[model samples]
Target: MNVSTATVSLALRDSPLVAEQTRERIKDHARAIGYIYNRRAASLRTSRSGIVGVVVHDIMNPFFAEILKAIESELDRSRQTFILSNHYDQLEKQRTFIDTLLQLGADGVIMSPAIGTPPEDIIVAEENGLPAVLIARTVEGAQVPVFRGDDAYGTALATNHLISLGHKRIAMVGGTDQTSTGRDRYHGYLGAMEKAGLPVDPAWRISGPRTKQGGFEAAGQFLALKDKPTAACCWNDLVAIGLMNGISRAGLVPGVDVSVTGYDDLEEAAIATPALTTVWNGQREVGRQAARALLDKLSGASVKPSQELIRPELHVRQSTARPVERS
Candidate 1:
C-alpha cells in the first residue's frame, strides 16, 4: 500500500488516534523499506519555502564567484535552495531583482549592494520581515549586518610596500571616492604617504570605472603625463592586468620601468605575464562567514548587527621592485 508521508509521520509518532496494531505495523514497514521524510514538503506544510535570495554586484568577478560557491555549499547543507541575481553594478537592476525574489517568496536575502545604493531598500527588506545580510559592501545608513575584508589596511600595506621601494610619485588607478571600500582604501593610501612625509599629488591619482578598459585608458593618461608615476596601485587584479597591457603598448616594461600592485590576488594575477603583486582578501572566508551569518538569522538565532573585517595578506610577486635607479 502507498502510504502518504503524513500518515507515516502519524504512525511513527504513535498518535493515540491510530490503532496500536496499525501504528506498529506501519512503523515496522517504514523502517524495513528505509522510508525517508522530505524536509521540503514538511517545511511547505508549515508555510515556509526554504528558499534564499543572493544578489552579487558582479558575477564575472572571481572574488564574487568564490563567495557564491561558499554560499551555495552552506545552503545545500541546510537543505535550502538559493536564487542568485547579478546586479551588474546597476542599482535599479538590483532593486528589481530584490523585488522579484521577494515576490517569489524567498525566506531571506543576502546581498552585496550595488555601489551607491541607498539604505532605504535594506530598511524595506527588514520592514517586510525578510532578514537580509550585507556582504562585501554595506549601505551607509543600513542597519543590516555587514561582512567585508579590511580594504583600508590592504591599501595601506600596498602603499607602504611601494613607498619602501623608493616610489614617492605613486599613482592609484581604478576606483572612485564613492563607495566606502574605495573611500577607505584611498584614505589608507593617503595616510601612508603622509606618514612617510611624501608629497601627495592629485595629478597622479585617477578615479574611474573598475573595468579592464577603464584601467587601460587610465594607464594611457598616466603614461602620457610629463611626470609619470614610477609605481601604480590598481583597484583590483583585472585593472592591474589592463594597466600592464597599456604600459606595454606605451613602450614601457611593467616591472622594469613602472611597478604595479593590485588588490584581491585573483588567480589570473599570479598567472599573468609578469605575475601581479597583490593583496589577498580571502574571498572564500568572507563567503563562509556571510553564509553562516545568514543561516544563523534563518534559524531564529539572535545575531547582533556588526561588521566582520577580514585582514588581507600581501602576496609578493614579479610586478613590484625597488626603483631602477635605487637598485
Candidate 2:
C-alpha cells in the first residue's frame, strides 16, 4: 500500500520491470477501487498502442475467415488488439484503412493486399513506420515479408488431378488476372494442362467469377459450350460448390456428369453434396506466420523481406472421377 507512485504506474502498465506478484497486487487493488487504466494515456507515454491492423479482400469469404481466426489467436496470445478491414479488392478502401492505421499509430499491419495495390503503397507504409507482413497475395517490390500458399503449385495439383481422371477437356472457371493470386492460379492451370499435352481451348478459361453467385451464373454459359468440357477446375471451394449446385439444378449429376475440382479445402467443401476434391491452401498457416512476422518486426527483431510459400496438399473427394461423356 506504501509502494512508490512510479512502482504503481509500472505495475499498472504490466511492465516487466515490476515484479509479477506486485503487478497482480496493484491490478487487483486498482480493480477493487474501480480505477480504470487509461490506455490512451498509457499509449501516449509509451508510444505503443498495443494494436495491430489486418486488411484482407473479404472477411466473409471462408478462406479469409480461416486465416483471420489464426491471426486473432496468435495476436491474442501476445496481448495485442487487432483491427480488421475488408477491402473487397478495392485499392482505395485498402489505402484508406492503411491511412487510418497510421493515424491511429498502430504497431504494425498484416494484410492480404487488395488487387491493383502498387508496391509504393507498401513502401510508403513502411517508410511511415507501419511494418507490414503480407498474406495470400504479393505486391512486387514491396520489400516485406510475405506468407502465402504456392498458388501456382496448388492449382497445378488440382489440374493434374483432373487430368489423372482422364478429362481431356477441362474448364477453369472463376478468378480474374487482376492480382498475383489470380495470375498464379491461371498460370498453374495452364502449365499443368500443357504439361499433360491436353489442349486448353480459349473458351475454357472463364474469367471474372470469384463468388458462388458468379459461379452459378457462369454455369449456363459453361453448359452451352459447343464442345462442353467434362470437368471444371474452380478458383475456390465456394465456386466449386456453386457450380455443382448449378449442375444439379440443370439435372446433371456433378460428380458423374461433370467432375469438378476446387482450390482451398474450406470446411464446407467436405460437406457439399458431392464432397469437393480441393487443394488445401494452408490458410491458417498463412495467417499465423504472417502475424508472427509482423509481431517480430514490432519487437525490433529483424525479419527478412522474403516470400514464404506454404506447400499445398491435394484432398481427393467425391466430386471428381473418370469423365462421363455427354451427347
Candidate 3:
C-alpha cells in the first residue's frame, strides 16, 4: 500500500522495470487483499484480447484432434486463449464463427476453411482487422499463409506403396472431387497408377467421401464390383479404418483378403487391429507452424504470406501385403 500507483501498475503487469523482490511482494499483497486484475481494461488499452480462434472441419476427427492438440500446446505456452469451432464444411457455419471472433476482437484465427470457401471470405476477415492463417484446405486466390501436407505427393506415396506390394487393381476410396485436397489426392493416385504401367478402370475411382461412415458405406460397393480391387487406397485414416471394419463385416479378413492404405498416419493407425499402412501427412507439424505464424503476425512480426507444404512419409505395417490371387 505504501508503493505509488505507478509502481503497483508496473508490478501488476509484471514489468521487468520493477525489482523482482518488489514485484513478488506486491503480487503477494494483492493476492492477500483479494485484488482482481481487470482483463477487459488491459485489453481495451492494448487492443489485444489475447483470444485466438481455431476452426476446422470436425474436431472429433482424429486428424484434427492431433492438429488441435499441437496448436493448443503452443498457444498455452504463449498464455493465449483459443476458441475452437467446427464448421462441418458448412459455409454458413464457418462464416458465423468468424463473425463471432471478429466481434470478440480476436487477435487471430487459424482455420481449415470449409468447402467452397472463396478467397473473398478470407480477405474480408483481414479487411476487418482479423488476421487469419489457413491449415489443411486452402481457398483459391487467398494470399494468406497456409500450412498443410503435400496432398498430391502424400497420396502418391500411399498408392505407390500398395502397387509395390503387388496390388495391380487398386481402388481409391472415400473422397470428394469438390475440394483441392480431394483433387490432388485423386490425381496423385492416378499418376502413380500410370507411372507403374497399371491399368485403372474409371469405375475404380469412388468420389464423395471424407469420413469413416462414408468409407464404411463405400466398402459394399467396392466388394460388389465384378472386378473387385485387390487393394484400396483410402482418402485418409478414418476412411481406411472404417473400410477395414466393413471388410471384416463382409466376412473378409482385411490384411489377408484385401490390402488397404490410408493417408494421415494418425495415432490410432498403429493400434488398429490390422495396423494400417499409411502416409504421415504431418498434421501436428502443420498445426504447430500455423499457430506460430499467427502468433508472430499478431506480434507485428513480418510473416510473409505463402504456402508451406510439409513432406509426407510412408509408414508400412501389417495392412498391406501381396495381392491374393482370386481364381
Tens-place lDDT per residue, model 2, 78-170, is 999999999988999999999999988899999988988999999999999899999988999899999999999999999999999899999
Taking the tens digit of each residue's C-alpha lDDT, what string does model 3 give over 1-327? 699988999998899999999999999999999998887778888788999999998898888988999999999999999999999999999999999999888999999999999999999999998999999887889889999999999899989988888889999998888888899899999999999999999898887667789888888989998789999999998899989999999999999999999999988999997999999998899999999999999989988889999999999999999988978
Sliding window of 10 residues with minimal summed lDDT for model 1: 39-48
Question: Which residue pairs collide, candidate 3?
Answer: none
Candidate 1 Cα lDDT to native: 0.85
**Rank by lDDT, descending?**
2, 3, 1
In model 1, state the lDDT of residue 71.
89
* lDDT (tens digit, per residue) of candidate 1 on 19-48: 788788898887899988676666667656
The positional error of residue 247 in candidate 1, measured at the CA in angstroms, is 0.9
TM-score of each: 0.88, 0.95, 0.95
The C-alpha local distance difference test score for the whole of candidate 2 amounts to 0.92
TM-score of 3: 0.95
Candidate 1 residue-pair clash tally: 0
131 in model 3: Cα distance from truth in Å?
1.1
Whole-model Cα lDDT per candidate? 0.85, 0.92, 0.92
